[model samples]
Target: MPSLELKAPSLELKVPPVAVMLLVALMMWLVSLITPVIALTFFVRLFIGAMFAVAGIAVALAGVISFMQAHTTVNPTTPNSASNLVDSGIYRFTRNPMYLGLLSMLLGWAVFLASPLALTGTVVFILYMNRFQIKPEEKALLNVFGEAFLQYQAKVRRWL
Candidate 1:
């Protein structure tokens, strides 16, 4: 009988996170064009749009906070590229604040466009981020930061 050796799968993939985000945004724009739903009154739409804007702003602020905390370059796709591992402020809350910020911005665009299809794109974006961006980044962080990364993971949610 031949003995089989089990090997772990490769951690990295070639897909760019920015490309994924752009694709989601494009899909949302397409949906807005097709469905063309004016579901809310102007005032209500404005309010919802404002709320989404606030979300985007908050997400951006989180990203800024993360960047400042790390005092390093901001590049999510390359976790090893980071000079420091930030576990403070917004980093304390979510491991991927930049992605969260981008997601919020996308959601804001959808709400401002007033398209249900755009909202659907937000769901797809979240799913993709979880599978591709966040997972890989976490693995890289674990390898880079070791137990410190694990401890941070235990405390901070992936996204909040």
Candidate 2:
């Protein structure tokens, strides 16, 4: 007799995080087209959105820079390729600053669109990234870095 095995639905690291972010942005735009905008002045929305966008860019860039300095691969799809574990710079705050930064940019896009419905994309993006991208990356990292990775995970929040 053959043993029966159950299989889980997988989305693990198949899509690039940036591509996911862009797709979410497109969905947000589509939602904005049909939804009513929030009652805010254009300038106010632009200023706030721009602030979020700038902050997101800075945080994401910091993560990339830290990886570069450590001579590690910044490729999220290939976490196993990392040469060294990075615990400095923005990484000290959130373990996944790049994802957080992308989320921030999506939030900025939602604000700029002024559509309440568009904000839903942020939630979707977070859930998707958490399940599909980050989980797999963390698993790979745990394999590569072992105890050190566990210690880092204990110290840092996944997202902030």
Task: Go through the candidates in order and give the clash count of each.
Answer: 0, 0
> Please, what are the lDDT tens digits per residue for candidate 1 over residues 49-155?
77876876787677767786768766665767667778887777777777787777777778777887679988898887887677877888788889988998899
Where in model 2 is the C-alpha error above 4 Å?
Answer: 1-10
Model 2 per-residue lDDT tens digits across residues 1-160 = 8756433235678789999999999999999999898999999999999999999999999999999999999998889998999999999999999999999999999999999999999999999999889988999999999999999999999996
Error of 2 at 154 (Å): 0.5
The TM-scores, one per candidate, come to 0.79, 0.93
Taken over the whole model, the C-alpha lDDT of each candidate is 0.76, 0.93
Top lDDT: which candidate number? 2
Local lDDT at 71 for model 2: 96
